[model samples]
Target: MKVAVDTEKCCGAGTCVMLAPDVFDQGEDDGIVVLLEEHPGEELHTTVREAANVCPAGAISLS
Candidate 1:
């Protein structure tokens, strides 16, 4: 799966990073969602999807 984060819509909630640290991170300055790994393995799909679901700003996308 591929993941994308819309920085403009991100609220720096860090949900993605918290849920899937291997696949997502936060900018030190802005705390926005940062895509750490684009095509994560299948094992990580669930966490990534959960992150997308919990994102308050709807900043994360999975494809």
Candidate 2:
């Protein structure tokens, strides 16, 4: 699976980081969503999807 995060659309919510730390993170300075892995392994797919779904800003995209 592929993951993408729109920094401009992020609201500094850490939900994504909580749900999928292996695939997502928060910027230290502004707390925006940061993409840790553009392509995560299969074992991480479920959490990644959950993070994307629960993102308050709808900044997470999957392909």
Candidate 3:
């Protein structure tokens, strides 16, 4: 799966990072959502989806 984030839409709630630290993180300076893995393996598919679902700002997207 491919993961992407819209930093402009991110509120830095950290929900994505908490759900899947391997694929997401926060920008050190702005606390914005950072996409760590654009394309992750099947092992992280579930977590990535959950992160997208839980993102309050709707910044996470999977395709």
Candidate 4:
């Protein structure tokens, strides 16, 4: 699975980071979304999807 985050669309909600810290993080200064892993292991796919689902800004994308 592949994970991608559009920082420009991020609203600093932190939902993605809370759901999948292993694959996602937030910028300390702006609180924007950060992609920690562009391609996380399959084991993390579910959580990553959930994170994407819960993202209010629709900044997380999986392919």
Which prediction has the highest lDDT against the true structure? 4
Candidate 4 clashing pairs?
Answer: none
Clash pairs for candidate 3: none
Model 4 weakest 10-residue run by lDDT: 1-10
lDDT of 1 by residue, 8-53 (tens): 9999988788889999888899888788899999999888899899
Give lDDT tens digits, candidate 4, residues 1-63: 887788889999999889889998889999999898999998999999999999999998889
Residue 17 CA error for candidate 3 (Å)?
0.5
After TM-score superposition, what is the CA distance of residue 15 in candidate 4 from its true location, in Å?
0.6
lDDT of 2 by residue, 1-63 (tens): 888889999999899998888888888999998887999999999888999899989999999
Ranking by TM-score: 4, 2, 3, 1
> Worst ten-residue run, lDDT, model 1?
27-36
What is the C-alpha lDDT profile of model 3 across 1-63, one tens digit per residue? 878899899998999888899899998999998888899889989888999999999998888
lDDT comparing candidate 2 with the true structure: 0.90
Off by over 4 Å in 4: none
TM-score for each model: 0.94, 0.96, 0.95, 0.96
Model 1 scores a TM of 0.94
Model 1 ranges off by over 4 Å? none
Error of 3 at 16 (Å): 0.5
